[model samples]
Target: MTISFSELDFLKPELGAEFTGDGVHFAVFSAHAEQVDLCLFSPDGKEETARMPLPKREGDIWSGYVAGLRPGTVYGYRAHGPYDPSAGHRFNPNKLLLDPYAKQVMGELAWDDALYGYRIGAAEEDMSFDERDSAPFMVKGVVQDPNFDWDGDLAIRRPWTDTIIYEAHVRGMTMLHPDVPENLRGTFLGMCSDPIIDHLTKLGITAVEVLPIQYFPDDRYLLEKGLRNYWGYQTLGFFAPQPRFMAGDRITEFKTMVKRFHAAGIEVIMDVVYNHTAEGSERGPTLSFRGLDNLSYYRLSPDDKRHSYDTTGTGNTLNVAHPMVLRMVLDSLRYWVGVMHVDGFRFDLASTLGRTRHVEFDRDGGFFDAIRQDPVLAGVKLIAEPWDVGDGGYQVGGFPHPFREWNDKYRDDVRRYWKGDEGMIACVSQRLTGSAVQFNHSDRGATTSINLLSAHDGFTLADTVSYDGKHNEANGEDNQDGHSANHSHNMGWEGPTDDDGINTARARRRRNMMATLLLSQGVPMILGGDELANSQGGNNNAYCQDNEIGWTDWSGRDDPFVDFCGRMIAFRKQHGCLRPERFLNGDNEGPREIAWFGEDGAPMDEEAWGQAGRRMVVLYLAKVGTNGDTGKILDQLLIVFNAGGECELRLPAVNGAQAWTRVLDTGAQAPFEPVAAEETVKVPGECVLAFQSAS
Candidate 1:
C-alpha cells in the first residue's frame, strides 16, 4: 500500500477513510504534526502489515491514497512531532491514532499500560515520553465502503409535537428480555425484533432515544472495578456504530435496525456524545484526537497547556472552537443523519458543544450555526442535555429555536410536588403547561421543552418513589457518586415492602407521576423500563453497572403499570389540547387551548394561581373542534391534582357540560378502566385525576 507522496493523489484534504474503486484514500487532520505515517494492520487486526508516510500536507490535513487497500482494511496513524507536554504537543510516533472520520473501527482497544504515551512508572509523569509501541494495544479504523442499498430508507421525520421519546440503552433494553432470542438479545437486531417493536408501539412512543451507539471505550477504571461503562457516554469514535451492538455485518446490521424501526413508523434518535472523547486528562491514553493533535483537538488550559480545560466533567473537552475540529463534529452529525438514517439526536453534555471562543455558552455558536444552516440537520430533531459541569453551564432555558432542551426544572418540580413538598404549586403549574416561564420566548413553542421524570443519568421512575437517597455502592465510589438532590421520597417504607398499604401507596404515586408526565404539555420522554415499573433497587447512578442492575426485567410483574401507561398515552394522543402550538396567554383564541380554575370551580385569580402549598387545583382544557375552524368547539377536559390528602373534587362545569368521564384515576384499583366522571369525584391523597366532558 506504500507509494511516493508525489506519485499518487495524497494531498486531498477530505478527512476520512474513503473507498475509491480499488484503493482507499485515508486523510486526517494534525496541524502540529511534522510527519504522519499511515500504519496499515492485518485483516485480523493482530499485526501491523506496513507503515507508509503521508509526506503531502495540505493545510492541517495529512492524506494518502493506498493503491490496493479495500474495505475492512484496518489502519491507524503515528504522527511524528515534538514530545513537549508544556507546549501542548504530546505527539509520540509510537502511539497509534484512530481516524476522526472512521466510518467503522475493526478492533476493540485492549487496556494496557503500554498504550500510554508516557512510561508507566516514570517520575516525569506525562512529561516523560515512552518509546514503546502502542500499535499492538490500539484499535484500527476499518475502511468501510459506506455503500448500502438502504432500500429507499428515509428519515421518519415525526414532528416534535407528535413525538414521545423513550430513552433506552441498546443492550439493556432487550438484554434480559425472555422474548428476544438468546443470541440476538443484546444486539441491534435484537432491539429491532418483533417483541421490542410491539412493546414500544404499545407504549405509544414515536421515537427511541437510544443511549449512545457510537464507538466507545470500556474504560480501564471501570474494568478494574469489575463494572462497565453501560451508558456509553465516553465516546471513542463519533462516526462508527458500536461494533458490540452488531451481530453480523456492522453497517448492514445498523441500517437494518433503522430501516425496521422506520417500517414500524418509529423514528430513531441517537444519543451522541460529541462534547468529549474517551481520552481523559493529561494522564489518559493517547487514543485518537490526543495522538493526532493534542492542542488542536482538545481545549488545553490557557495557563498550562499540559492540562486540559474540561467542561463536560469528562477528563477532556473537545476544542470545537477550532474550525477543523468543529468541521469534524459537524461532519459526524451529518453522517449519522444522512448515512445512518437516524431521525434526530439527543446530545449528551450538549452545552459543551455550544461553547464559544470567549469561554461562554452561546446559542448561536459555530456548532449551532452549522446545524441550523445545514440542509440535512435542519429538518431533524435536535435535543440538548443543555447543561455541562462548567461555568454558566446551567442553560436549561437558553437554547435557541428548534433545539428542545432537557427540562430539569420540570423533573424537579414534578417530583417535589408529588413527594409532598410545600410551595411547589407555582413551579408545578408552569411545568404542567410546558414551563412557559422558561420557554416562552422567540417563538419557542411547547415542543421546546423535552420534559422527563427520569433519564439514564439519574433514577428510573420506579426508583424515584422507592429510595430517598442514591445507592451507587455497586459503582465502587462508596455510594457517593450520584446526585444528592434527588427530590425523592419513600412511601412509608424504604426499599421493598411486605405491607399491602405501603405497596399500594407506592403504586399510586408511580401512576400519579406517569399521568402528570403524559398529560403535561410538552414532548414527554419516558425512561424505557419506567412503563413496566422497572427499578434498580435505588441505584440512581448505574452508569458503570452493566449487569442485571442496569438491564430491564420483562417478567410482566408490572402488567398493571404497563396497561396504565398504554391507556394514558392513547388518551394523550386522542386530545389536541395536550400538545398545543403556542403558549397559553389566556387569550384562548384557537381550537385547542387551556383555561385555569380554582378548587371552588371558578376562574383562578392571580392570588390563587401564585398561592404556595396549595395541593389541590383544577385545570380545564378546550380541545379544537373537528370542523377545522379557529373556534374551539369540540372537546373539553378537567384535570385535577390532589397531592395533599384524600378530598372530594367538585367537578368544574366547563361550558355547561352535564357530566365528566374519568379517562384516568391514578388512585383507582383499575386506573385505566372507564368510570363516569361524577359531579363530585372523590380523589385519594397523592393522586392525579383526568376527566373529559361527556357529550
Candidate 2:
C-alpha cells in the first residue's frame, strides 16, 4: 500500500487507524526543542516550500504521520528552540538538519556559513547565533523501501580457531583490477565480481574484513589539500551505506554484494567507527548529532559544559553511557546483521564505547552489556581495537570474554625479532605461541589474539624493512603527521638502494615475516596488499592517499613476491597443527606437543634468552595423539630461523619419522626447488626454512 503525498496530513492523525504501509513517518528526538517542522522537496527538486508542523510531542520526541510520502521522497527537519550555546542549546528554527535515524541521505553538503547555526567570524564564534535557513546547504534524508531476496544465502560462521581474516578496503581492492568493468571499478559490484572472489578463494582466507562503508563526509580539509579520506574513518551517517560505493541501483547493490560473497563461502566483516561523528567539535559544522541534541548525544566535560570529553581524539566521543545513545548503536548493529546480512563488526577505538561519564573503562558499560545480552548480536563476531587517546586507554589484553582483540604485542615482538633486535627470545617465543600469558586467562581461548604484523594504519611489510623513518612529505603535512616510533631498521641504507646485498636482505626479511605470521598459533589477519609487497614509499599513515600508493597495483603480477604470498598461505591452510584452538604446554594430556629447541638440538637455556648479541634457534615438534597413539604420528613440521650473521643448525631427529623434505626456503631465488626427503639441505644465514617429516 503506497500512500501518495497529497493523502498524508501532518497537522492531525487518526491514532486508532494503524499506518501499516511503507510511507514516511517523520520522527525527531530533540529533548530541548519545543516544536519541529517537516519540510518536503518536490520530485524535480526545484521548489521546496511545503512545511508541516508535527502534531504530537511525546516527551522529547516529535513525530507525525505522512500518508502518501513513499520511498525516494527527499525531506529535512527544522527544530525550534533557544539558540544559546552557553546554556548548551545551539538550536535554530531556520537551520535545516538531517535526521539521526535516516536510512539514506541524498546530496552532499556544500561548505558555507549558512549551514552553521552561528556566524563563522563572530567574536564569540558558535556563541553568536545566526538566522540563516540551511535547507539548501543540508543533505535531505530519503524514506527508503527496504526489500531484498537473499536466495538461501547465509552467513558462514567459521570457527574462530580455523579462521584466517583478510583486511582490505572495498574500493582499493578492485579499483585497479583489469577484469572488473571500467564503469563498476570502485562500486560494490566490482568487489563481488570474479576477479576479487578468485583472489580471496586462492588465498584460503575465510573472512574478508573490509574498511568503513558507512556514509562519511569527504572532509573540507582533505579537499583543500587535494586528497581524499581513503580509509573512510570519518563517518557521517551510521546506518546508511556510502552513496559513492553504490552503482546502478543504490541500496540494493550493497545487499547484492553481500549475497554474492556469502554464496562464495566467505564471510564479510565491517570495520565500524562509532566512537565519533564527522561533526568535529564546537567550531565544526552543525551536522546531524550536534544539531539534534548536543548535550544528549555527546559527552561534555562535567565541570565545564563548554568543552567536550574527547577520548577518541577525533573530537567529541558519542555518549554511549546514555540509554538512547546505546539503543542507537545496538539498533544499527542488529539492522546490519539481520537486514543487511553482515557477519560481524570490528569496532574502531572500541575503548571509547566502554567508557562511562566518569571517564573510566567499565566492563559492564551500557553499550557493551546491551550487545552482549542481545540474542541476535551474541552469535556474531565482535572484535575491539581496545584503546583510545584518554588516560589508561591502552587495554591490550584486558577485554572480557566473547571479544577478540588486536594483539599489538605480537606485532611489536615479531618486528623486533626479525629485524635482529637481540635479547628478545623470550618475548618472541610468547608471541609465536599466541601470547598465552596475555589471553590465557578469563576463558578466552588462543583465538582471542588476532595476530597481525602490519595493518592499514601502518607501514607495509616491504616498507618496514626498507625504511627506518616515515617520509610523508607526499601527504603535504611537512612530514609531521605520521608516527615517530617506527621500530624499523634499514639494513644499511634508507629507502631503495642499488646495492644488491641490501635488496637481497630486504626480500629475505619480507618472506621471513610472512612465514612467521602464518605459522603463528592464533587467528592470523593478513593486510590486503602486503602479500604483493605493496609499499607506500615509506608513508606509514596513508589515510588520505587514494592513488596508486593506496590501491592494489596488479602490474606486479610476475613478481616473485606475489608467488611467495600464495605459497605461504597454502602452507598454513594445509597444516592443521599450526593453528591450534588451545595453548600448548609441556604437560598437557601426555608428552609436550610443541618443544622449543636451541642450536644444540636441546631445550633452550635461560642464558641464551638473556644474551644481547646471540640470535637463538627454535624447533617445533608436535606429537600426533594422546598417550598410547603418540607413536602413530601423521606429520611433523620443523621451522628453523637464523637471524644472526651465519650459523649451522643441527636438525632434531624424530622417533617415527621416515624422511624430511624441504618445502620452503626463504633465501632461494626465482623458481625455487624443493629437496627430496632425507636430504641434508644447507640453510642460509638471516633466513627461515620449513621442512615436512613424513612416515
The numbered model that scores best in lDDT is 1
Error of 1 at 414 (Å): 0.8
Q: How do the residues 1-695 of candidate 2 rate in per-residue lDDT, one tens digit apiece?
A: 33224434453231111233644567667787778777777753334657778777776667777665567777777777777666667777777777776777777777778877778899978788778777777777766777678888888888887788989988888888889888888888988988888888876778889899988877778878998888999887777888778776478788888998888888999999989888877777786777778878888777765567799988778888877777778778887898799999999999888895458887677777778889999889889998999888888878877889998889888899988887777888888888999999877787889999899988877789989999888789999998887678788998878999998888888888888888888888899888777778899988998888788776654267767877777778778668777777755554356777766656667777777876766667563664676645544677776677666655666444446777777887741366764434456787777777754
How close to the true structure is residue 253 of candidate 1, measured as C-alpha lDDT?
A: 87
lDDT of 1 by residue, 1-695 (tens): 44433366455546898888778787888899899998888888888888888856787778878777779888888889988899999999998888888888776789998789998788968999888888888888888877888887877787777888999999999889998998898899999999999989877889999999999989998898788888898898999988888887566788889999998899999999888999999999998888889999999999999999999888899999999989998889888887889999988888898886568998888888888888989899999998999999889889887889999999999999999888887788899899998899988998899999999988888889888888888888898798999999887778877899878888888898999998899899999999988989899988898889999988745988888888888988898778787776566444435777766667778888677768877777775654565464566778887788877777776566678888777877777677886677777777788887787
Give the distance in Å from residue 302's predicted Cα in candidate 2 to where it truly belongs: 1.0
TM-score, cand. 1 vs. native? 0.97
Candidate 1 Cα lDDT to native: 0.85
lDDT of 1 at 227: 82
Error of 2 at 273 (Å): 0.6
Candidate 1 regions exceeding 4 Å error are 1-6, 10-13, 588-592, 625-628, 656-658
RMSD of each: 1.9, 3.4
Query: What CA RMSD would candidate 1 show?
Result: 1.9
Model 2 misplacement above 4 A: 1-22, 44-49, 497-499, 621-635, 653-659, 669-681
Give the Å shift of residue 415 in candidate 2. Answer: 1.4
